[model samples]
Target: MPPEDRSTPRARRPLRHLRAAWPVVVTFIRSWGLMALLVAGGLAIAYRFVAPPPPATLRIATGPGEDSAYSVAVARYAEALRGQGFAVELVASEGSVRNLELLRDRRVDFALVQGGVAEAGRGAGLVSLGSVFFEPAWVFLRRDAGIGRLPDARGRRVAIGPEGSGTRVLALALLEANAVPADAIIASPLAGAAAAAALLAGEVDAAVFVSATPGQGIGTLMRAPDRAMLVDFEERAGAYATLLPALTPVRLPRSGFSLPEDLPAEDIVMLAPAAALLAQADVHPQLVSLFIRILQAAHRGRQVFAPEGRFPSALNQDVPLHPDAARWYERGPTFLQSWLPFWVAVTVERLWVLIIPLVTLGLPLIRFAPPIYTWQMESRVLRYYDDLRRIEEEAAAARDRAARDAVEAKLKALDTKVATLGIPSGYGALLYALRRDIAFVRDAVRTLRRG
Candidate 1:
């Protein structure tokens, strides 16, 4: 307690400020206490919508190999993700059936799956990011076989692709729907370039290539010119769609598969299923949203079979859209894409869900805030002064000792009440000043008794 230290401006200033600031501080503390649980619970609920960081690398099951468009599309996705600091590992599989199996088992992070290969048993465990491309069932035949349509190929050697491909699943389903007896057709396991080679070598009567348009097999068969002809679905495209809900009818121009040479002399109608990007149910939403943006960039624009921006479509059966994708289809990309960089946009978008509600509450809370503070400072503590004035007035009018004694008792009780009051640490200066004022009133009563 040095005299110079006590008199220092800094020391006195804080003490004076503390006394002035207590009511504001206490008012805030009380207000915050009332809202603490609500804010905490609301934030906890908002946290559920926050997506986790995308993985450093992702493993996706693509079809057959690099020659296949499914595989090529997956490779493009890998390249795009790589530029964004994420590595996408492409795993070659038999085809759509195998992709579905891998996704069901959670063996891979993502897959290039053919539509309609997914079975109900594992349907709940997976979701589609949207169809990225079309896998058209291209049936190329030897001109001499006289195969004008699907039924004509019966009893002819047909290579629909090997065991588990989406090609095989779709080919068989279409044949069964067309009422082509299974016993009449000789189905071969050869697929891809092998199937195309078989038909060219005269080893098979017809080869069915279920591939993304402009397949290597189709290009190879195009070299045959007049010898190989595309079967026409003609007006039967809608019939096929009506018969099989999963198949979408599409028309390809004479040279849709290859531009320079008119592969087919005229337009031919065909059925195809979209090749979708599918993932396990637990896949991170950030990665789902990230992949869709990248894939849309990769799949958008006109292709041989589909119109520009026709793919990455949410319209498919057998599977639901991934939640992120449903939002994507409804909202048309994350809102942050317009102004911010990719990474920053994703982070902000993830937090934006929480920010909305907090902002909504904060505006009204701040707008109506003055009354609460005024009551804390001007009314609560100041009411003690009014009580003291009433007691002084009663004591002055006292005609007998009993009334004066009652006023003294009330003052002693009031002093006791002030002494025992509990308050926060920051309010200590105000509490100290209040006690000093109470002491002054007690001294005045003491002097009245002596007089």
Candidate 2:
């Protein structure tokens, strides 16, 4: 044959083989298609139970303005989260009260809230990572006001922070505890720098501030010792702490802010509340873990009031601790979390339950499926054995040569049907055995015909 003709036969040979394979393909589908569908369905149902991937974006509520310590701290959090492939939106708010409102409304995923701001029957469906820092009640008074203690501010002008502010809430609580009526002081709605400015300008007799020691307003007031003095809650600190479960008795040692200048000449006792990082109850565990790690790194150090490794603590939290955060604090990160990247670790953790069941049940099913399929295919070829035996008996009982020949012809037709039947190549041994039996029957029939 010419080269071209030889190539044509080679190409046509593939087509013939494909045509021959059509029946085997059909038979295999009949056997295994249902099994494939079942496995797929099982996987889909398992997936439903798995924890969903963490959200790509997170919204956080922080204190008002870029200058606020809350905003600055949350800005750092946003940067860290962004580096780990999350998009963080920082929403500035009036204070902890507004932050709580944003969190309750589901308008933000996380918020920095003061310990005492979340009142009874109001803080539902929220959880805390932990208290990150202390926000002390810094009551700055002008020298002319002659205010030696919290109650002495009665009937005097007081800047009690703005509306929807944690400072305002705490100030009212402390004043009420001191037997100072709400109407007794001329309350000013100014806060932070405005409150500090008002107190410095002699516009207000006293200003109540709830903030970290490093806050700008507190720093500004501390710098001017001649003009303002911080009130000492020495006599009632223990009593106030008992009255409000959120408040902790904190003492600032002599000259805590400035030792050389003898700024605070004596130890100043104050009632301090912790600032907690709050999140929705249903926040993703991965995000919770990440935030907890960030908070530990940020706050687990010595501060003006707290000792080294004292903060990022589960202590003094107004809201319940997040389960994941609690776990992190108790037992640290999981083994996979310690080794793998953030998303990879979370993915594996989420799917681990599904994987265990699949391995346990699926292995046995996989081993059993091939044997079941083999038996089904072999039965297709073996069912004709009974017909072959009946033909052999008819040949043996033939009354004449013509009768024997008719029996032989019937046997030949049966053999042809068996040969033409479509069976998979894997079952060729069964097909050959059936063919050999048919030949045996033919030989016996021919011998009877000769007799």
Candidate 3:
């Protein structure tokens, strides 16, 4: 140790360093660390209540044949939804009656149901987006059937449509209203092209069709006007509409089918029921909104019976309107929906409920947490004053120099501990005051020693 190796670095004092850092670690854990835990807990609770993302896949029930209006319209809907990142599977059923059954059983998420098919008790757990289009009742008769009116079909061969069809439902209701009992007519369970072919071949005296758009069956009947004629419900159209609240009186104008042919030759007044887009009540609100938007794009154009923008309408719905669809109909799309991508807009709308509470609660915490942290830090330093007061009392009561030296030694230790405290810069004034109080105690002890 001759020259003490003058240039050598001193050994590190790890214990003193730990002592200085300990208070800061404790203060942070007691203040900011606890605050962080509180915030994390709040977020966890909020996340539990957050709405989950909508399903990526959707299933819809349409009519039996691909050529039918229900099937064709739903196919277009599937295409549009697929463009927006959805996987759509179409389930073909008999008609509106079967579609309603599929929707109620949860076998399908959505269905195109004719308005009058959903009876009072059968529509539970279902809601309507809106009425998409009108489906008119077309009663086509063989030219020699001698059936002038609905009641004239009594005791005659009639194709009233197959079971689980909207046409059959309307047919039975009209026949019943006209006092034609089910057993009174030879009722053939024929529909679509089968019904059309039966009437053309004279196998059935009459065929009832409830369709929106002209398809193979309707087109065949319209072309063969000489063999088959669409009956005009002119006299009883209003009466039928009144009997069935869902039925609306509509007219198929002359040449409505073919402008060159002057088809119909006269306005054909018919009783029509709207085809409503029905959904399960539990369907996601975002999906409902998306469907409404899709329907708006698809049905806003003018059609044979409806004026432009008259469809996809809140009116003519058989079931209660879905809350989300009602909002969309009332206010149109939200600003976020108008600008952002579909999923992005949905995500923001879903999270908005969570974000609001967090902001409201976090703002006040943010405003006050720092002050609380400072108080905690300063309190740590202030706690030493109790020991300082105790040492001062012992110094004043000292009877001899031995006692006085012991008290002074304790005072020096306390001063060294205070010097090593790791208070933040902002709290330096409180630390300095504590040190000054210790100094005053030391000065009093020294005066006692001298006396």
Q: Could you say which candidate leads in lDDT?
A: 3
lDDT of each: 0.75, 0.84, 0.87
lDDT of 1 by residue, 230-345 (tens): 77776788788888877787788777666677656678888888878888877887777778888788888888777898877787646888887888877876667756777898
Report, for all candidates in order, the number of backbone clashes: 1, 0, 0
TM, every model: 0.69, 0.86, 0.87
Sorted on lDDT, best first, the list reads: 3, 2, 1
Global Cα RMSD, each model: 6.7, 4.1, 4.0
The superposed Cα distance between candidate 1 and the true structure at residue 190, in angstroms, equals 1.6
Query: Best TM-score goes to which candidate?
Result: 3
Winner by TM-score between candidate 3 and candidate 1 = 3
How high is the lDDT of residue 215 in model 3?
68
Over the full model, what C-alpha lDDT does candidate 2 score relative to the true structure?
A: 0.84
